[model samples]
Target: MLTDLPIRKIIHIDMDAFYASVEQMDNPDLKGKPIAVGGGGKRGVISAASYEARKFGVKSAMSGNLAAKLCPDLIFVKTNFDRYIEISKKIRKIFFDYTDLVEPLSLDEAYLDVTKNKKGNPSASKIAEEIRARILNEIGLTASAGISINKFIAKVASDYNKPNGQKTVNPEEVIAFLEQLDIRKFYGVGKVTAEKMYQKGIFTGLDLKQKSIDYLDKHFGKSGHYYYHVVRGIHNSEVKPNRIRKSLAAERTFSENLSSEVFMLEKLEQIANEVSRRLNKSKVAGKTVTLKIKYSDFTLQTRSKTLPYFISDRNILLETAKDLLFQETLNNSVRLLGISISNLNIELSKKSEQKSVSVQLKFEF
Candidate 1:
């Protein structure tokens, strides 16, 4: 089916050891050193480990103690969520400059559909090269990119060249590439499935292609249809953007209950700033700004204001939030301060005005 339709241009971009790379970028001494971004204490899980650490058998999702055993000199650092979020925003902005259709798998990986790009460049490989260069120059980090005719191939291509590299898979070469690929390399075919496939003599794409759709369906259920087409270099998935805000929330549990307006305003500023950042990152502007307060007596109250236009500006958001906080009477010591922005506007385009005019006979009047 992919061969029957016009070829599309898709790209997958993944940062190299995202959190560990960020740590290295911030500290020059950590370069070429085995580093992990996570707590080194007991009961800590590794968030990310540098390539150097990987050579010693350290990996993300592994327990920190296990990583330490693998790499005796592994350096573990505390996670800085704010800093990581900031860098993620910058990387996402670069993707948007090239194409509006970007699907972020996480903070470090994304799928971009460049079939109709903002740059109007027909060559997807060239666009990927430019994007990779821009990210390295601006973010002080390296990323790997894959360019292909569809999402499945593009995702596979990105991993082909890891740690600051790029790879392209043209439509014509897709079949040859798939034929030689090991079954384990296929998306959704993990270790368990790979073992099962191996037992069935389905070790490669060619082996998978030989199997009937019904046979695969009997084994894999709905995903069998996906395997049936992908082995033949066919994939129809589209890049989807983050169009809605799943939750709009901001909260601060203070160390001490405070009745002072000054202290409460300061806390509200921080909450509003966080909400604004999240709204902007998701490309959503909110019409309602909600203020929440929890008193020392365990009583909770909330007030919300809906504005004429959606807003994401920090100053306007904070100012409105502070005003709402002051409007409510402080009956007890406040133990918490919160703000949330909701009712997202996904579309960026302005609405066009519709006008109607009628002219009467002035002479008759």
Candidate 2:
């Protein structure tokens, strides 16, 4: 379907081990060493791991004890979100120089529609290269990029070469590149979906292409149509700027599980205060409150209530969370507690629709 001569040029930019890399860039001692951020205690979980640590099976979300076991020399550093945010702003400013059509997915990654960039560059790949160069020279950090016909393929290609590298999946090569792609490599297919697809004999993009839209829909539900089109190189999602957060949440994973609801109440208050602080910082308020509960056995549960009006005051958030906590009986000892506010006022603000443009191919990598 992407064969329609005229197509949009998209680029996916991803920073490399951002938090850990920043720590290393600031501290010479951390460079070239196995280091992890935010896993300093006996029960602590890693937020990010340096590439050196990654070689020893260390990774984000892994337990500190396990990481220490994997790499005895692994050093743990506390998270500095303020510093990360400062640096992220600088990176985003760099993006605005090349294009106003930038969509930041997180602090460390973004998508750019450079078909009509401020730089007036015809080759999206060149823009990506120059952007990566600026990030390294100006920010003292390395970044990788994927340039292609759409967000999905570009996102997939971005991972092909990582840590100070770039990949460009030109228009003509989109089909065969996607056909030979591993099902696990599809942008939206997570581990669970990949395994489910694998069980159904959908191992590669080509295999997925073999199934008719009906068969895919019968097996995969709503995502079936999504897969059918993407495998044929047909993702058309546009890069949206000023992306707003749908929900704001604060969660705490305890060093030890609490056996009583009374103990959780105190923790819930702390989480609610954090949620409120974040809400005020973002200048947003929500009408829906949700409480997340994670059991020691790894099972998870959520409870929510919609209010008559939006509220972001710490006391109100605490009260709403307290109500949700008691709405249901506890299933097991709780290891994690989270409070979130949703249906925010900012979501009500509308963004202008992006106009689609099609023209004969006029650029090359």
Candidate 3:
């Protein structure tokens, strides 16, 4: 029997080529150029490539040498994580003005539940449009948005319209939309999985839905249940506001690999600033500070220190990060540097505590 479910409203917002876009927004010289933000060494990887760079087959995670080969004229830029986090905070604040039910996936993307929004607007589509416009107006960066009845469809819909576009999928249109979508576009299906599905003759949602639960389970394991419902447009995930944060981190791959301590320290300071900003924004304090370094051989190493007290201060974080970096000996030229805050505290107010107690007593009576 088909269960009647209450209509939900979800929005997914994704920033296009986030790091590259931020660099372009800050420097007019970089605008309209094929830009790649990453290490330019033999083993260095591309962190983020601009849309122009993508046109030439450059992509994130691609080896820096291959990226340069793909687009010889590609301009590489050092990542400025501090600037990106600042912009992310402004964007998050814009989302909070509409609904508190915001779940950040990364610095560039998030899911928002606006089923019962502060705006009192009946249409989620209108709210998404307004949010996109506000982001452009306030942050000077373009963002694409998707509005739908659930997270699955909303995330897919957001990508339908590229760079500064909005797309919406109403509940009624869900099935037809999924029917035509490529198997690769499905959320959990990566390149390897899609290739496997193709070998099994499962090319579309209909093909996937036609397979028996037993058959799917035999192939995909426990995630088969998720695939079964997703193909049928039966997602029931909720927008949880009180999400526990597992990790907070900021990392940057340089435009050029460096062996110099002076140059590395400059970049480390910026990463530390970003990590601090993110911790402050989430109202989290971390007891551990970790430093990650990736060498030109693609080898990675990490050093971490747990502090006596939880901290979110920029200077303290930077100093700790600097110390960790100094302790490590650079075997090969360093390509990437990262700082992460591990332990977190979800802050609640003492004043709100008394109010909550009073409300509970009133309800009891």
Candidate 4:
């Protein structure tokens, strides 16, 4: 461990095939079956798949037709966001029992800072074990976890033993653990980026560490610096709680591209309504509105404006998106559009406001 950097006790929790597992739990007929949670028709995308389906390489974001071809008996269940959100809230309540420094990555995953928790637990490993057990006992769902000195390592370690398991990277093991890890397993290194790293002779974390910071910066740009530090187990991103929502957003991907402003307006209004609804659900309003455009060629662009006061009305959101939409001409036909509101009015609690992270390297997380 680097003496200069602070040691934190972070845990990343990920639900095992969350959507598919929920389907199995709710409908016993789907139990122990190869299930894909999403549409099965043409133009359908698999949102999630069960471990049973995973044996045949069926996975999330896979084309429905291809998934069927791979697993002939794959059962498709419709996506149920309402049920998923309801279950997610229950899981979050469980987290608060130990600590309030819970940062939810999504409905199925979160990062919790257990360095100083309500339970006064010293062992993050035990905390993780108990949390997983409680989820299985109380909610009837299995969750996996990783405990380590920081969020990046915790996130990576969570996948070591999956489907209701946990791994802890002790303070002494952090460096060696990272060195042996495959570059492909690194959180931010996707297929394309991994290929780029491979071309630079960076197949593992050890290989990544061998390169000079300058060399990595030349090849990977801004992310080069990120790769340089994280391989040394030095990611310092904190587990910001739910009270700190930076923005509220809603987006939709179109089956057909919108070729003109006239066609785009109809879809933009719908997205604005969703953004407005989410803001109200959180009981917050924003002063800035941003219009995100994804062109048919897959390029992304955004136009934003800050308002004089916060607003959450759908009409106000629609009008703001409209103004930004007309601010610039289309570079290409848009295949996706989104509306986001930022600079929120989510006042932090006094207790949360007073909280701060402090580190002690001797603690066994």
Candidate 5:
């Protein structure tokens, strides 16, 4: 089974404070200044903060009120997702030039399987350098990259050098790299899982490697199987290109809290229509429809209903969203409304997909 697994060269590219960086590049006055991209009101949450703002404890998802207290001079710039999306497409184009085996985690980060690249470059390190350099030269932005044998290590190494740097973990150094990594730093280990591992004396990768698979299975259940191999630098997940989007959604925050269910239903209708339009444009339908509601007190609630058949009809989506909205009693006045559809069938027409793609040669582990 081990010999059947493939050995791959993976590179993870991540933009540093992407939104904030974009803001700085557009407005020279904001350069080197502490800034955040998001609403900066009493109830607003930050979407991203510049490196300068980070020193003041301002971070993404932090409440605007708290961020203000952390840094009095923190400038809050409203998020321009349209602009960000445009920039992201350009970056993806650059990745495609090197290899089509690229998986975007978000607009700011992606994983590339560059073992066999279009440039025929044997060195993955050199490819990463060229990619980063092109981004800086053409796009006027900086990116950091990590190179390794798998996704997990590549992701972790990408964070080792921030702002503008890259790290490569050679095949021979994989074991030592994993052994010395902190448990908290390992991918998939969240706060609760980290605390649980620390309680069990599993503070580092080495400590985690010492546990028997059966012992870990007893304590951690299904995740035990994953940790058992990750600790030994063994991850066989493939870099899937053109990954299907799981869901599509549209949401809007009201300037004032709404009290009437009739007004709320009207908002849901518009949101559902937008979601329907997006679904059709993508040529995908979903079985699950989710309604997300945010109350005036900043509390959020989500309700979903799965249909027996896939649908992209506006009427069906609006009716379903209305049902989900009225199914539960309003605990408080609503401040935001959103509608999303998931469990998508994203198989596109054969003619739409690009042809003559180069296939990467697989290597036995």
Candidate 6:
């Protein structure tokens, strides 16, 4: 249990509407206006929405048409991933300066272990405040931070005060803070899980705490144990720095559902090229290729193939994607097509080194 273990100071930092905020910051005309950063077409889904647009019920993943209807004056901007990546690198540099124990969740969010930081600062709250301030001054954008004894509480606390704010949860207050929290607000408790908890009469942290671990496991499967520990403030996941990249992918939803084999082939070629670009940008290659297909009716299908050698060339990726697409029969008109490469070579050298070290140790013994 977390109470029995030495507490580690953790902080979860999340940017404020990252992509949309970057658009607003670069274009003064977009500032203080309802804007969405995404494709603006019949089939386009919003990637991010500014707080102003959110006021009128706009949200990420909503259809562009629906978002436009919600806020008639809403403006749409195409995604600029290069700019977002540049800014993300800057933010991550700030995190590394403070602690090497940083785990990035996305381009806009990360968990940091600051139990012992480079600055030798004792207060996590002060560190969070300084980090947030640095982002605003250096990057011209706002961020929110949550400071607590562990990652779970820190992640949740970050949302309590958003858009240039910070919150701290002390060790002594962890239990009380958790008990009063709504089940829906708990990390890993999505809408479906919350409904299941509601059906079982578990509405809050205190209610979840009442269930025996056996009962929870019996009802909720493996996640049951997770809930049991989390309700008691027992999350102990570490913040791992320089985590390996598992895969690189590119996907797109069509403006119109496509059924023609020729059209599907063309789209696959484009998506494979995108995957190749991302792989090259990351300086990685992969041995496994997966193709994802989503039908207009929402049914999904996936096909994958593992190659004998790692590859990153655009032609090879496209050809492999083509083979996978043709191998599967068309079940329905496709609405979305995606290509991804996994089993990346990024960590292969490290694995080889570890194996060599183990062999050396065994020989010495």
Instruction: Candidate 6: list runs displaced more than 4 Å.
Output: 346-365
Q: Which residue pairs collide in model 3, if any?
A: none
For model 2, residues 32-79, the per-residue Cα lDDT tens digits are 999999988867999999999999999999989999999999999999
* Candidate 4 accuracy as lDDT: 0.90
Residues forming the 10-long window of minimal summed lDDT in candidate 2: 354-363
Candidate 5 ranges beyond 4 A from true positions: 1-5, 253-260, 294-300, 331-336, 347-365
- Best of the candidates, TM-score: 2
Q: After superposition, how far is residue 338 of candidate 6 from its true place, in Å?
A: 0.5
Task: Kindly report which residue stretches of model 4 are placed more than 4 angstroms away from their true locations once superposed.
Answer: 255-260, 294-310, 323-335, 343-362
lDDT of 6 by residue, 73-121 (tens): 9999999999999999999999999999999999999999998999999
Tens digits of per-residue lDDT for model 5, 231-311: 887777778887768899999888679998898877888888899999999999999999999998889999999999999
TM-score, prediction 5 = 0.88
List, residue by residue over 163-271, the lDDT tens digit for candidate 4: 8999999877888999999999999999999999888788999999999899989998999899999999877676778547899998887777888999988899899
Query: What is the C-alpha lDDT profile of model 1 across 205-246, one tens digit per residue?
Result: 999999999999999889899999898876766666853444
lDDT of prediction 2: 0.90
C-alpha lDDT of candidate 5 relative to the true structure:
0.89
Q: Would you give me the overall lDDT of model 3? A: 0.85
Clash pairs detected, candidate 5? none
lDDT of 3 by residue, 4-56 (tens): 33367899999989999999999999999999997466557778999999999
Q: Which is superior by TM-score, 4 or 6?
A: 6
